[model samples]
Target: MTANDRTKSTGSTDRTGSTSSAGTPGRPLTGRRPLAIVAAAAALAATALTATPAQARPAHASPPTALYTPPANPDAGRQILDLVRHRKLADAAGVLAMTATPQAVWYGGGTPDEVRASVRQTVVDAARHHALPVLALYDIPGRDCSQYSAGGAADTPQYEAWIDAVRAGIGSLPATVVLEPDSLALLPSDCGQDDARGSRTAERYTEIHYAVDALEPLAGTKVYLDAGHSGWHSVNDIVPRLLAGGVGDATGFFLNVSNYRSDSELAWYGKLISSCLSYVSAGGAAADCPNQWWAVNDAQAWLDAHVHAAPSAMKHFVTDTSRNGQGPWTPPSGVYSDPQDWCNPPGRGTGARPTLDTGDPLADAELWVKIPGESDGQCTRGTPGPNDPERGYQDPPAGKWFPQQALELVHNADPRLVP
Candidate 1:
């Protein structure tokens, strides 16, 4: 299915009165007095004032020379704006703060010329502010196991043409392209979406390889392939896939793109994957490299004994802090046959702000690869009914603005999204 097809199938009106589309989307923090919450909300409202939208910058005024802030999807700011109009300043502040932070712009469906024009506009906009835009190229064939957010190019040829268009749109401009989330982690074979001949899986690899080759050589482009998250795909399992998909040719891999794994877990997972990739490149077997499940001391010790490459020599990675502040959710045991913990779990919050100055050597930067306020599709939580059993309401479809979850993310933001 293409993005339009998915949108047509699952499209519905979100709380903000917008039609849902194909995309990745997110919850809140915990204990606090009512007064403290109110005061923090006010502080956040004040902070939003300082985060001027990218377009507001004068043609020559140098904005923060950092991650590119794309134009707001109406859903992103609508909740905040509505709350502000209602004099719900506290709630408005939370939503404002969430939207104010820079997030990645996703492109999953378009004709070659259409995608080219769209991408060109984004890159040009970023160039105006001297910012590096994070572009997520998600139109791989057979994406998302045909589940929520299921959509991509119809086939390899079309996909390649789309990539060429993206490259043309980029045109030697600086950008960090997150190439095809889940393209590697959730292959067609993994979801039984492939045939006996495994043609789809082979094509999947070919497509990703093509994307890496197409985008990595750009003069100012840095491309990162997806590696799922710490919660899934051990270092051994993911390393081989990354290798197959040409991680060596790309900038590196990204972890927790649209999941809720904690920062500590993701960092350790990234380090292990980086170390293992280095070890493999040096003729060490991936199976021999310690995985994330190993005890910390033992894993480090294994790397010490088997991997001598400096951190600079290893593959670097970025993590999604978009909605990991509260980490992964744990549903009540024995309640649902499938928890769908990743799909719009309640009480999650935004993670660390996007930044390239990560102190870790092998970790390139932390990014909000997933938009913070969009829905992860309607999370049924194993029920036959439409409503999520846990939340008692039908969640918005993927890529739609989810106002309740947006507020939760604000309230629960780790490091506290306060003034």
Candidate 2:
């Protein structure tokens, strides 16, 4: 489905002030607290009761396959899996306890050594819990169109060196990297006013190639290049960008990183891009190609026809399930005060967490590329300071925190939060 076509669950809301709840008479519904707390508490109680029955059963009463085996990093997968599986919060939490870490941090903004040291500590801690630390790379030049999401590496050269240091931090450990979000699709031939740097298409490709080339060789590092989302660009438009930006060298591409595009849309978009890549490898030109807007019935049909299961043959795709439960909120007429509505638009809700298994051969894995707690930049309605509730600053743009955004996200996801 197109992003606009994806259905919004019954009680979803836009966090931005433009929308209000249906009931509760005049009070400008600030948030969705009462209902979310009730849901979570009920879920927790049900989860405890369900475990009692399971514990009484024989150790191997059910075949290993029938049992719900949590992942080695259950915390990383829980929220998303629970949402996907339609399980109550408590049950998902039970599975999550198996491998949840305290908090997480990304290494950027400091000297290479400092960044490396900090990241190494985080990685080491995650390894201790046998969890895969989710790392987000957000130091690309011209990040967030150089607005509030600005403040990346001073230059491309420094950015590359920073990437090198971050890689060293990972240091042959089990980790997943969501590389330079919005760096691919959001980049334009011209970024307003900052024309001096120009479009680093060639440089961008080199950096992406370098990151993939550097990380994938590591024993347990899985690096995914960020592909914006289904709404931003058509597969045909983006596939060439991927190829130009070193999709050939990376482990694969990631879709819906930090955006609210649905699984069906993501799967279809991913398959289309992958298929186009296949066609290109066989000498098809990206330009002059028709069928740019080819439609599919759903993700399954798209995958069956286009997904190449083998990672090496068909470059795989990973999707971000961070905050996309309800696709995107399109402003009525001219509701946006800022043109950058793409940055944390109001009324949006959290989506599933990141995952490695999508049950589709074409889809290599799904992941929470967007760190939930981190701000998508300053919102038009919220304040811009640190953790400012009015501004909604859960985590600094690219910093670190433990169990960040989960509580607030769960709150936001409640239908009661929506107008």
Q: What lDDT is reached at residue 23 by model 2?
A: 11
Q: Could you say which candidate leads in lDDT?
A: 1
Model 1 misplaced stretches (Cα beyond 4 Å) = 1-65
For residues 163-213, write the lDDT of model 1, one tens digit per residue.
999999988777898888777777888778889999999999899999999
| lDDT of all predictions | 0.75, 0.52
Off by over 4 Å in 2: 1-105, 193-199, 288-292, 297-312, 337-340, 381-408, 412-419
Residue 416, candidate 2: alpha-carbon lDDT = 25
